[model samples]
Target chain A: MGKKITIEPVTRVEGHGKVTIHLDNDNNFERSRLHIVEFRGFEKFIQGRPYWEAPVTVQRLCGICPVSHHLAAAKAMDVIVGAGTGDGLTPTGEKMRRLMHYGQVFQSHVLHFFHLASPDLLFGIDGDPAIRNVIGIAKMHKDLAVQAVMMRKYGQEIIKVTAGKKIHGTGAIPGGINKHLSLKEKMSLLDGKDPMNADKMIEWSLGGLEFFKNFHKANKDLIDNFAAFPSKHLSLVRKDGALDLYHGVIRAIDADGKKILNDVDSQDYLEHIAEEVKSWSYMKFPYLRKYGPKDGWYRVGPLSRMNTAEFIPSPLAQKEFEIFKAYTNGKPNHSSMHYHWARLIEILHCAEMMKDLLNDPDLMEGELVTKGTKSYEGVGLLEAPRGTLFHHYRINKDDQITMANLIVSTTNNNMPMNLAVESATKQFISGQDKITEGMLNAVEVSIRAYDPCLSCATHAIGKLPLQVKLYDSKNNLIDKRTKD
Target chain B: MEKKQKILFYGYGNIGRQDDGVGVVFSEQLSKWVEDNNLQNIDFDSNYQLNIEDAENIKNYDIVFFVDASTKESVNNFDISSIEPNSDVSFTMHAVSPGFILNICSEIGEHQPKSFLVQIKGYEWEFQQPLTAKTENNLQKTLIFFKKYLKKLLIEKKIEEIDLKSLLKIKND
Candidate 1:
């Protein structure tokens, strides 16, 4: 037996995940695996519940991204209720949901960059684990930290108003929305107090982008090549190939930017996608069915979204998008660390979308819902903060959910995460006499780029402090380290 | 009677999970009781979990009670501990601790509220399951004890004048 090292419950990510590396007798790397230890039974839990309860019931899957689940479930139920597909909702209903979604993406991406990713960027990976966190950012960069808190608060306030409450919001219904944006709410969000309004959000968003661009300019090597690898990318793009997070057709591109899965209706996702189950991890690896499981594994989330979209619709983001595109010369970017750069662009885009939505008159007055002939089966797909989220449902005659299937964003990126860990281990941990904190963090940094929500993927609750254990050639425990 | 100090009871938990909802339920039940009895200078809020924004929300109150459900073996029925600003960060930043929120509040806000964490013991945590019978009993006892504690707190001129130990003694009844 050779040495085996395990990093259990990766820190800083939203949920619990573990990484294991096998080394040959000479301490050279043999293999690595990213394991999701938490098990999810949300599909089973939703089976017997009334179909109408899905939006609220699914929020229990994750406290961090409940709005994503809420909206996705409602979109799925919309089909069962005979609301046409993505374009079927009333103008007010669609716009309201889009505002809620943009709020979710803005806050979620902000949380990922500021709270989880910035600490690593500010303090070197090998920096003292105790001080390498958001608190440390607060101590050293007070202005940045305060800006993050207020920006996050602003996004949450948007959710509160649009979703109708903070937790388990019931604003998005089956066919449409339950309420329109009132004048008071509209004015408050559009031109509220100094830092709480839309303009401030857009301003801070630009600032965040500038911060990342400066960091990238300084740390080109680490940002571009740390865990870089070539792989396929996947996401939903608008009919004209614009980046549309709320609704779109599924599209995918190979490493060389060749279209493998052309624009396909979201309802036909099963025809083009399939999930493979591995015994080592609780999460499933989703792949393009045309290539089969072996060669079909692809990357998703911020980096992939950047690779897949042809152009950004918003003006500011489009300008940034062009710069991002010119970097790769219209080729797909496979760098894992660049996910942060792509995510910041998305934040700016979301902020711009929110401003436009807040100013639209339809939000203040319009039909709330549109109904049509009932359909028993429906599929809902949206660009969640992490990646593409698929919600499929089948309802019985009694209106109870008889079958439910959910392919959360984290699951979609499982294979890419594993590949990232493998790349990091080969580069940073191979043939090492001692595994330094920096080496261990190098492996973690690759995984963090995707911002995987293990709790959402596994539908469970637990802490995510990291623990690493080393085993010698005889499979004996040789050393251990823990960060709580 | 002295001027009433603004107090807030902020509860946080996943209500869809069995027993984990005790904290949120505690807030909802107590808010109704306060309204029915015409209690003044009290406010309530609940969420799936606490986050950075809460620091700003709690900073406005003169005093705050953060309630949650705990599964620690050491906790029998419940436990109440005063929280102070500490920067020890949680491994997962998905949700933050009361101490962390307090630290952030002190860092950014104009006023720092006196804060306490109230933990109600919970048993199960399955999805969509209602609060277990044993957990319900514990919640009832905690609610009864809290009503008296608040009444005493509102009447007293100083927060220090209220004896937490004496109020805890009422838990047996």
Candidate 2:
């Protein structure tokens, strides 16, 4: 028996997960596994509920990104309603849903960058864990911290104004949103009266891009090669191949930036995607259907979305997108850390899109919803802040959900997260003595780059804090550290 | 006359679980009491868990009560103790403890509000289960005790005017 290292309940992102590194007989690194510990059985419990209730009920799965689940479920329900009627959702309703969804994506991305990822970036990853947090950042850089809070608050305000609340807002529905954005709400966001006004958010987003650009330039080695690996990318793109988060056809590109699938209808997701379950962890691995379980694994979320999209439609984001691609030599950037950069770009695009949507007069005055044909089964897809989210539901004629299946972003990136951890452990952890707290944190940093939502991914109970334990060849505990 | 201090009651836990929702229940009752009595300078909020953003939220408050359900057997049905900020920060950004939130506030804000944790004993934690009968009984007992206790703390000008009856009732109840 060789030494083994384990990081239980990886922290800083949503949900609960653990990392275990197995060593060979010679004390060399064998492999590392990221274990998702919490499981909620959302798929099983959601059955028997009315299909119309899914958009609202599923939002409870994740407090951090409830809007994503809500919209995804609403989109799926749209198909069900459209099945009964020949026509789908009205154009007004679709646009309203898009506006609300952009709010969610914007807020979620801002939260990730400012609160979760910035602590590590601003302060060195290997710095003292005690002060390497949002608080630490606030103490050192008051202006940046205040701006970050205001930025996040602006995103939340967008959600609150458009949806209903900052978290778990019941805005989207089967055909469209429950309500349209009132002129008061629209003007509040657009007008500079609010501290976190739209114009300021756009400005901050651009500043954010510049900050990340400078950071990347300063730390090229860490930013470019940290947990870097080749993998297929998946996202949704418009007909013209522009990045579209709310509505678009599925597009997948290989590691070499070669298109594997283009313009696949979200309704046909089942035909192109399949999930493989492992007994070791609660999370299921989803892969491209054509490649089977072995070679079918693909990555999603910010990095994948940026790579798969032809170009960003928003001006500021489009400019940053070019610089983003230049970093990878026009190929898919494999570095896990770059996920942070890609996420910021998406945020910039979302802010710009929000401004565009709010400016449209048709959005303010319209029939928010239309009666759609009721169908037995339907699938809804959207680009969640983390990645693409799919909500599939089967309902009987009574409109009660008979079956529900959700392939969240965290589940899609499970394989890559595990691989990233393994890669990080191999690169950083040399021997038993070298497995310091900082090294353990490095492994966790790689996992955090994906921003896995373990709570939403797992259907189990009990909070699992981050705990790392090391064992000797004889299976004796050598060292133990836990983050409460 | 001195200005009334701003107080915030932050209750956090999964309400779907049987007893884990005690914090939320307490906060709800507290909110009702505050509203009924027309208590000014007091605010109530509850959520699934604490986040980093909450630190800044607590900066303006003069005092904060962090309520949550506790599984520790040694603890009484209802326990209240003053809490201080600590430097142990979590990299996991999803959920944070009240102490951690206070620590963040202390670092970011000009003043750190006096804070306390009110832990209510919980009996069950099953998914989708309602509050267990035992836990419900404990919650009611804790509520009455705090109702009288918080009243004095709010009304009295000095700590010397405080009586230990409201505090002792927890052990007896």
Candidate 3:
């Protein structure tokens, strides 16, 4: 047996991370690990503040997904005050919020695909990391690059008109929104100034999908067998039991499509699942009741959310799900390989739903806010682009937030994602193979597949290229910042 | 077929991180008033406007304000008696600094129906709870000023021009 190799501080995700892969001289199988190294006490910090303020305050978690945090924060407030009747939200408000989130979905998914995930897929996994980026994608596919920015801009525009800002929507109040879109905006959200632009985008995306199809088709064998494992899914379901971002009952489903619980309440999350900590890092592994010792195995996020829901809400998403159902018998238990598919399907759904949202006559209504005051404790749950996000808050009588607890999607799936890295380690038998751009890019791509946002996960650690140290079994540095 | 101009006030910072979000807090309070008095003339746009391009639609607006806490190290927040908008700011790649954008916008164009800015002096910007005594105290004063500022625009019926076309400038360049 030989000492283990470490890839310190995995890049691309929200916060600090490290990957460890065990090696044996005999070319035998060994273990691997992915660990998240930092955690903040925002949950503990917000313990006694007013409840209504929690949404606005906690939204500082991550700029990339502030709305995700905002929705969760609002939901937490909703439960505390027990005012779920869409409060002061106008019919237009509800539809508008949905469209806003869909816009985020498109922005995030496009970013994930082109800026985050494309380098590995396009550059042959073992390609050059220096060029496999937004810049590289721009060079290789200029049209796609322009579309990504345009799409992200449009998404941000929707956020601006509805919630009040593209990233920091300061006016989206709990009872109701404080802003309204003009009739001009109502039309633009469906299709920008050039109505045919949407169609052009769709046609362009189909071509992109066709491009991805060739990659998947060629790597069918490698993808089918890589990082397949047992995992569960969890997400918010519509009251009608369909996949939804807001207003839903929680669902948990097993790997084999078996329903674990279809009507789980947010308050009972702790009772149903427990997280255990490893001394090596701050990340916790959420575990099931049947699983002894709260291990870092319980998963959450888009894949898990999809698994939990009985059906997809968008027709395009539903069609994709039908194909997914046929693939892994209803569970997509893998690494970065297929997350791209799940993500693209979601992007299509968002585009279609955005049109539906813009077409609603109620969206033009003026009375888009509710009139009331609320101060109570509650939990909010929603499916962030990455996974399941939870926001729990405790408020004082003054309606200020006193305590806050957040279960970010990345945190929930931290442990399982590590297991994935471990599984990938077994494939690199030729220890002589250099820590190629391909290998590191593959790992980063897989992490982005989660569309991982550490800022949301950690609520701290601003700026990027965060570094961590790696030590061999003998405590000697074999590799510093190289292979995963 | 008329475009509605934005009535935006840029505010930034993480509230939990102390005084970082003072600007945002003020914006929230002002927005509430806009809601309360049935101020249909104003609308809140998206969060931080990184580049001017991010808010291309702002060109359609008759007025735009960027609100934030100020303690002018370069001059002095107390120097506001002579403060005026500048116009040389070229939008940065990532963000259009509020003060900078205002200066640049004012330079190339004649005054629209109206435009104004309001600032509050912040004492402590460290991560803290509820505005500090100074910030809290200053909020009321700022609010009063904002109300008057808004009234000035309203009195001018400046929003009326938003319905006018051939006036929109999608790109500042």
Best by lDDT: 1
Query: lDDT by residue for model 3 over B71-171, one digit each (tens)?
Result: 55642331122124433222111223554344323322223323434456767743356777776767676666567756755777665453213121211
Tell me the docking grade of candidate 3.
Answer: incorrect
What lDDT tens digits, residue by residue, belong to model 3 across residues A1-484? 3556555556544455666666565434467667555566667666665566666767666556777787777666655654563333567556766767777777777766765666667765676655554445555665565566566666667667777755456655665556666788876655666522345445555555566667778988655655556776667677677777665666776666676766777667776766677876666666666555543255565566556666787676687667755676655455446777767767777777776777777777767655445546677777788877777666667676766667788877777677667556655432533444455445554555666665456655432242333344565765555322
Candidate 1 structure quality by residue, lDDT tens digits, A1-484: 4788999888789888899999988789999999999988999989988899999899999999999999999999889889988799999999999999999999999999998989899998788877888878877888898889888988998999899999889999999999999889988888998888999999999999999999999999999998899999999999999999999999999999999999999999999999999998899988889899999988888889999999999999999999999999989999999999999999999999999999999998989988988888989899999999999999999889999999999999999899999999999989988889889988999999999999899888877567899998778998999877
On lDDT, the stronger of 1 and 3 is: 1
Q: Rank the candidates by DockQ, best first.
A: 1, 2, 3
Q: Is candidate 2 or candidate 3 better by lDDT?
A: 2
Give the winner by TM-score: 1 or 3.
1
Q: Order the candidate numbers by lDDT, best to worst.
A: 1, 2, 3
Query: What are the chain A TM-scores for all the models, listed individually?
Result: 0.99, 0.96, 0.89
Name the better of 1 and 3 by DockQ.
1
Error of 2 at A329 (Å): 3.7
